[model samples]
Target: MKIVQSTWVRYHHIDLARELHEMGHLERIFTSLPWWKADKESREQHVPRGLITCNFLMEGVRRMGGKLPFYSKGTDAKLAVIHTKNYSKWIARNLPDCDAYIGISGSGLHAGKVAKSRGAGYIMDRGSSQIRHADRILREEHLKWNLPWNPVHPWLIENEEAEANEASLITVPSHFVKQTFIHQGTAPEKIRVVPYGVSLQEFHPVQTPPDNCFRLVFVGQFSLRKGVPYLLEAFKAFNHPNKELVVVGNVSDEIRPLINSIGTEHVKFVGIVPRAEVKRYLSTAHALVLPSIEEGLALVQAQAMACGCPVIATPNTGSETLFSNEKEGLIVEARNPKALAAAFTRIADDLDLRNEMSMACLERVKMLGGWRRYAEGMVAVAREAKALVLSTQ
Candidate 1:
């Protein structure tokens, strides 16, 4: 079976394509990432450069636009729509004959339609919750937190919805993402839940945590959607003399003031570290805290687990799919700082439990394997989509 793929960026598609190509299923994959970066990633994965396409000019423009002084969230939203539409059109123009087309949600609506018109299946790969569901909940969260909120642009939402409606199959990384689509009126049968994988080669148990200091690390973008405020409140309330909270990733402008207003004791902000550094942080920390409000499967949870660091996250992050609650990690309700604080206290006070969870994390990664599982699921979904198209014809 031949399949074509497109991704707006690297994300997990490189690994997915690597596995697919090895299985002799990938026709070729298109990406809007710059040529240099894309080539480097493909080389790292042992994927031949001949099996990939890169739209470096458009990617360069998008990158530079984001760095402009006047660029706001509003502009970012507008550019997202423009970029997706142009990229989709470009993909359609260069389309090749294949059994099916698999495209990232917002970036391939036009190409999906073109592929379908040519008697090929179109699969929409969504890595987040439904666009409408995400926008609504994030808006409410911003209002609740009293932060300046720029709502999701309607065109972007409309485009994503159109992609979902037109595709032969919708593929998501987690059941949480699939449920969001169902809640937003999409048929459950149209969606497939394929959890993401972590690179066991890249992340592993490096060393055990040092005694006498309880370290908690929060990775990913530091913003309201990630439940940073709740983490801050919980961290302050944990009340340990030698406790440390390492805040990684970029802090948004709106969250900066609120972070300043809250507890700053023993908190370290090391923004935008390298991938190697991220693994190091996950490996050394006592536990990884991800209080995100909405996401597909957080690969970090697995990465942390692979590093022998148990996770403390909410259900919305698809943590349940990673490890059993209270076995390998803790799960607390979202927007509940008190509960998070309590989880912190529980893990902090128990030494044997910590070691047990760490061991459980390593075993879970052993079972998860890596991106090979995700690639197998995608191939199965691709065949189903092809079958659906041929049966209807």
Candidate 2:
């Protein structure tokens, strides 16, 4: 089977395609230009260096004066797309000759709808539940941040409804996500649960601490959606003398003042480090804390757990699948600083518990299966879809 994948989500689809191709499938990926290079100068200067590769059709459209469909003539050729709400409609206009297109999440589903009218087999890879789950997180954040409760954001509600109605197959990352979708009016059969995998090579256990402070690292974008405020408040309330919170990510401009006001002497913000450097922080940290109120299956939690560091996350975030409260790692209620503070105290005060949790986390890593497993599962799904198409013909 030949598959073409598209998205602007910064996933290394080339690596995934390579793995699938090695397993006897012809795979081609199509992603948008690097988000950073929206201007003409950046694209011209960087394309030569191969900093980002343009999608076959997008490049042709820019070079030539017309939009042409991708034409590598082969009976087995198939096309898969990552649907984002921003430019999904462009997929149909861009790829007039493709077999199938897929949306990676509900947002993707909204994008895929545009392709559906063009006769593409649409699949929804439910990477995250944008409504039922997002609402839960919104409620939590509202209480913690004292913001207005607007669970049903008008734009998101429209996207969620469109995704449920249009996509033929909806893929979910966890049972929690799958269940949430079902409860939100999606049929159970439409939702397929596929858990995410970790890259063990990039993130593994470390031996020694880098400093005297018991490092508690949180890595990702600094936004309310990630429960950043909750994390800061929890860390502040954690009554540990030797511990420090190392926040590694860019803070949203809106929340900067609020974050700055709460964090004290022991807390330090290291904004947006390189991906390679993230592992170094994870290695040195005693534990990883992700108090995100809204998320699907976060890659950070998986990376941290693979590094043999215990994790403490709220149930609203999909990391709850990996960590059990007082088992593999602590699981706290979303947006509750008091609960998070208590969990932090438990891990910090009890050295034996921390050690035991770390060991369990390693075992959990293997049980959840790694990147290889995730790749194989993807192949199985795609092949099934391919076979169904072939049988009909």
Candidate 3:
């Protein structure tokens, strides 16, 4: 039951690696994090240094690009393409003997080919929609809003498509992402839906259900992609005398002017708070709102759920798949401020419904457990892929 995994950064992959190591199934987990940072980050699980393989070259390149005076979106995009190619080649040349290889999408196309030739099932874990689907949708959105838009770099898009084609199995964070791949002509059978889980240690229900002043929370980057402008508009229209909206996370430059235009009367933009503070806001708030136009699975929704905070989000955020609509919270249409405002008012008007939803959120998170369950789900997918590949061989 040996398995190899690759992730360019510590976006939940490190957690998976830690769980696999605990279960004695990790052959190696390749990452772009520097050796020291990797050890420090995964210290909680005590994932041995032996279980990690780092390509500091990738990290160095990223740092160098950031420091360059000419740094811009174009520069970042080029660096991404370069890193993907280099990382994939390095992994392909040094891949170890394992029954399965799971690589985060973009950096595994070449290594996946090598793994497949060795009778190892190649699994590509994509955290978001298919590249083409995402690019098209975002472009359309930006244009509709009359905002400047840059199409995704062709090299990155083509490379991701190649990785998807090369993998024997593909895992996405939510069914919304799965539908994107299916829409792109991929067979539905090859796509697996695996919604992410939050760390229960960092996020847990406080002793009280939401009451008193009506406070609305929105976590995550405040960007056009997240539909922040719409959220601001919704917040403006919602009628409440003692209401306050807490906007956590950094405000993206793209939406700064729109945010200013909306006027933050009762809105508090506490940009980039600590994790504990985020949990505090979630635990105490009446409801959390995520009106994202594009998303994989907005882990904040689940993190808020873990705090027993009812969430009001749109299907595009994969919120529909996590809990029942109007039960756990509300799933409204994206890019619609009226809908968002209506949902906000609905939750605020009924205290009993809010309390019930809060209890439901705690129970739901209990059933989901935490990263352990998500890690186990990935393991199941890997086992299925390994068995299918070995039988064919």
**Candidate 1 overall lDDT versus native:** 0.89
List the candidates' TM-scores in order.
0.97, 0.77, 0.95
lDDT of 3 by residue, 130-233 (tens): 88998998898788777888788999898998888888899999888899899999899999998787888889866453356799888999888888878888
**Tens digit of per-residue lDDT, candidate 2, span 1-393:** 444455454443443544554555433344565444323323332222222224334333333432245542121111222223334555444543344555454335533554445444556665666466577756776676765553454454666567667765666667667768877778887666667777777788655444566778888887788887778888888887788888898877657777778765687789999777887887778888888766778778888878778899877668656667787788888878898888888888788998898888888888877756766776666556444444544
In order, candidate lDDTs are 0.89, 0.64, 0.86
* Per-residue error (Å), model 2, residue 163: 3.1
Worst 10-residue lDDT window for candidate 1 reads 55-64
lDDT of 1 by residue, 152-255 (tens): 78988999999999999999988888889999999999998888888888998777777979999999999888999999998988878799989889998788
Candidate 3: worst 10 consecutive residues by lDDT?
204-213
Let me know the TM-score candidate 2 reaches against the reference structure: 0.77
Decoy 1 TM-score against native:
0.97
Residue 176 miss distance in model 3 (angstroms) = 0.8
Model 1 ranges off by over 4 Å? none
Number of the top candidate by TM-score? 1
Candidate 3 regions exceeding 4 Å error are: 207-212
